[model samples]
Target: MTNKIDLDFLRVTHLRGPNIWTYRPVIEVVIDLGTLEEAPSDKIPGLYERLVAWLPGLVVHRCGVGEHGGFLERLREGTWAGHILEHVVLELQNLAGMKTGFGKTRGVGQHGIYKMAFRTRDEHVGRAALAAGRELLRAAIADLPFDLATHVEALRELVDEHCLGPSTAHIVEAATERRIPALRLTDGNLVQLGHGAAQRRIWTAETDRTSAIAESIASDKDLTKSMLAACGIPVPEGALVRSADEAWDEAQDIGLPVVLKPYDGNHGRGVSLNLVTEEDVRAAYELASRKGDSSSVIVERFITGDEHRILVVGKHVVAVARGESLWVVGDGVSDIIALVDSQINTDPRRGSGEDAPLNALAPQHGAEIILELQRQGLTAYSVPLAGQKVLIQPNGNVAHDVTDRIHPSVAHAAALAARVVGLDIAGVDLVCEDISRPLDEQRGAVIEVNASPGLLAHLKPAEGPPRPVGKAIIAHLFEDGEHGRIPLVGITGTLGTSLIARLVGCLVSLTGAQVGVASGQGLYLNQRQVAAGDCTGWDAGQRLLINRTLTTAVFESNARRILAEGLAYDKCQVGIVTDVEGAAGLAEFYIHDADGVASVVRTQVDVILPHGTAVLNAEIDAVAEMAALCDGQVIFYAADADHPRLLAQRAAGQRSVFVRDGAIVLGDGAHEQVLLALAALKPTTASWPTSVLAAVAAAWALDVEPTILAAGLRTFDAAATASKRA
Candidate 1:
């Protein structure tokens, strides 16, 4: 029998090539879910027809439905099949057209095809796409095996008897959102008040879970300062003050030469310094009051020093910008107003539709200038006796020239400040004359601290974009084995779904760690769950969503789409954890050479792949079943002996592997295009369990040594310990 078939990705490889099927036909669908207003015509009956008709393969046999049956089994495995994936399938109709209220709801709509589509696209988009796609697919696939028929009937009978759904939340979610058949009861003729899960998934950790991360953030001034103090860093003497009255009292105690600011403020706002005269103090109070209603002001002894912002991540201080806010630097020709304009204009974050630097405060005034020059006993116009090393407070805010001076002590203090806060990432704001000087002797103080500091600052910030900083961070975040990050592969989509749960389960199990789940962005981002798209969204949060920007933003529900595309970039020397099709998983690392072409490195992918994958796909089932037969990480059964798939394609690869791992190369000259004598086993049980994985990831993050780590991983009995606790 001659039958046409398309390639469903068995093992990951480069884009389009020959298929495994001898005569099996291909199935394809095209669609646009971005637009949806009308419902469908027919339901399940029509859906089956549309799907089979469009499929390129001949109808071999019809797989009928049943609970825990082979059809569902095949469908689950189908996700790994690599065919061109689509977000929606307008070409097909929903199976048994989903049943609904007296009015029929379109059965399953586009999601039926989407289940497999994510897998297809994950494979097609290559590694980067797959990494993201795999995460998205995990989230999307949770909709299956809809409300059970028997359960729906039981629910309906209960509704009729009680005239009210079950008291618990689950019944409400089933009755309303699932639109499970409900008998309309006359509650003195009141409306039906049933509900469904507020959302299908809640991937966020609890309030306490998030609070820990915030503590390390600059959002809490007490924590920030405490951390710096722990590091034995020097700063102007300061204390957190609660009420305006406390601030006033403290400011008085601080006397005239003091700075009052919000304890947890950043970006140079809510700050007032150099109240040399009473007018400046009053204006400063007004600014502080305007900053916020819950404005907890900071009272500190202001030192006669220069200010600097030192960027640090882990043990490294990425960049140091000599302290300069818009106010201090001057153009000898331009007036203070013009000089302010020039400075603000150059600041991309500040100038473009942002609060101007000096609407309420001035960078340089007659008294300030005279004071700066007077300290040298001169005036602004006083020719500084041929570069008399004049010290300008705001004057130090020039374009950073770290090549000149960054005292080792200041760098040490900045790193200490970040460490004190118990954060792996931070930016230390400093006020110092010359970094080379001793902390006590230097006329400087740590002005502020930043958490999740902007990557832009470390790049070629206008003046440069913190590109190098980003590179360093990206490297550390995705570095392989110990001495690096615990590869964090974010899997989101219509997130909050089963895949997230499964992937989380899989990752924690493999790494032998606790599910170290943390929420991204803020409470707002967490509450909404899935980040939806713009324009006519059902909810208001959609309207204000950061949405997808070219910079560090998750696309509007399109993270799935991007993950689908990024599949190929998964190639790495260490380890990777992308889907059979390539997409996002590993963090993105960029390498730019003379061509200025930035090649994003996706690595440490092994962390994402689950243990039981062998039980799924037909091909992998066999290979994973015969684990001893497979040798090395990249055991491809390619078309030729000379080149494995990736090598034959001549693709450029990168290094990745978030935590500790064994490095292996595929398609080398000595071992190209060959099946291994002993296959690697696909895991049935975790080498390490969840808590162990977490411990390992944490240990890797802290750069624990291999011998120590292996001993720890070996000694850690996550399964037994967890079971015992349970």
Candidate 2:
């Protein structure tokens, strides 16, 4: 066998939190480049040219040069296999329809081994991209034929199976725009926005606030109609029928030209409208009865009006969409189904997926369309006479926006119907001749109130401006200024992060808040260690943030953790960077100097919320320099109160903590408060004083009282012992 190029994946880790990568989940892959280590892109014959020809879109990757076409420039300039792999994987995921924009590749101590990380919206897609990227790169390097289309097709399939459906993604995008953090609770659309006690969960268009009782009521169409009618919302006069014969009898009683539908069916499935004959009524009932939870059908008076869907969110009308009846005019040569494909289904808005505003009309959808065609005395295979108009769909597909034109009274009735059905957010289906006229004037009535309604119609209307339904949903879920986040603290450094995190947790707990800590020692909850061993990584931090009982949390982030996985949380209320002693362990990540270590550790300060605070070690010049990078307030801690960095913060009328004589001094420019004597703090280690100072500053920034801080410092040892016992 000819020598084969190998890019062996030694390990793969899914970091499901903010890490050294961007502020999203990413996959960290450890790969041994093997023979490829000796072959940079420029050194290998035709490798760069072949890769460019395969994935020319990779030129958009800005890389370190920070502009378009930068990755290609780097490739042409002789970048190694690790960096190339990062770009290839990202491009593959992008081409597969799951767009991801952040990536990084760095040395991992071993000569040929490197760590590559890229943003991953879906774990399965990320893994597939990595595998495909490896094969594609190997093929390109060896001048072997690679099926790029097939590889991309497989990754696209994974994306469709694994990523969020469009409805949930829109809401999540709105939440993200509001700066509210989100975490996927499952492999599907179930997502939790915010963290801990402040979280609100959403599954597609439905929310945690969507009542189960209301959903049940909405699902029972007959009950919903009764409820709406009782509330004076003008529901259609309908009766639930148990059999096809009963359906015809009910239709006769409702009078000629009646509607037949499943009692519990949604999305217009198994519904047949405007049947004047007994035969048509019985056929419609047979079609409707087999679809819902119960085989029960509802027969109602058919109102002569277009159907309109009114979206109600929290007692107000948020959107309105008017349905247009679907019809296909037959040509001389085409059958009915073929005519539908060429005419009705040809609309750009019609599609088979949720992203499509209107669903594609196909005879295979069963019952409704087939029966409608039969009513017209034609089968799907029948090619009607030229110029013949065959009705394909009588209602549903409310794809035309009419929100601005809806009469105030009609809007009020729609909201009332939703309220009567007990839905916090609902879609109220009403049939009316003129949406701008009063419901009473048009003889219009609310026909159905649906729970967990599809938002696609309003989000992607065919003829009018798309509505901001996602914003309305978010507003209903959370109030103004509420992003669903609990107070959080992040402590990062080589020397004192673990101790500082522990002390900060202790101080926060004294406020009667349930506090969680992820430290070098273990993960602690309420001063009790729940998990043993090192718990300062991204996984450990995620545990604390995901816990519902945690009202406040503190996490320790070290250089190794930062380089390997990234910071666990997205942003923090208080970010503390203790002394950056040296670049000791960072040799693995290619950091040989203090500046390189500072850049890695500064990621902690980068995530401080604009309204939050960053606590820096003034004793270390590099740590103090990170203060300027913080988006929030800066508080410096030092052994000496007169240290230049501490004095600078004091001069700027900012907060600082330092030792003044034998006592810990809390200073705010020309003002100083003596909190506790250094002798009072029972030190656990040589670096204990600095840790104590950093923790106090961070707690103070979080608005903890000085007495609580003093009490926590004094009792720190017993708490440690208690944590160990637990």
The lDDT for every candidate, in the order shown, is: 0.35, 0.86
Off by over 4 Å in 1: 1-217, 240-249, 325-404, 462-467, 481-726
lDDT, candidate 1, equals 0.35
Tell me the lDDT of candidate 2: 0.86
lDDT of 2 at 634: 93
> How big is the positional error of residue 510 in model 1, measured in Å on the Cα after superposition?
14
Taking the tens digit of each residue's C-alpha lDDT, what string does model 2 give over 325-347?
88888877899889989997898
Q: Tell me, by lDDT, which candidate is best.
A: 2
Model 2 spans with C-alpha error above 4 angstroms: 1-13, 28-88, 104-117, 137-145, 494-496, 581-588, 591-595, 682-687, 723-726
* CA RMSD of each candidate after superposition: 22.7, 3.3
lDDT of 1 by residue, 1-726 (tens): 012212222223321111111011112222222211122212112333333333322132123333333232333334221121221111111111111111001111333222122222111222333333233222233222223234334433333333321111222233333332121223321222211111111111011112356543567666666666666676667666765566556667767676766666666556666655444544455565556345567777787756666777677776776545433354345544444445453455443211221122233453343343444454545433322344434433333536236677678777777666655666677776667786778656776677645333333333532325433443333333222112222222222222222323333334333222222221112122332222111122122221221011111111222222332111111121112332233222111231111011111222123311111111222222232221223222211223323343234341111211221122333332211111121232133222122223223322334445444333333222122111
The number of clashing residue pairs in model 1 is 103
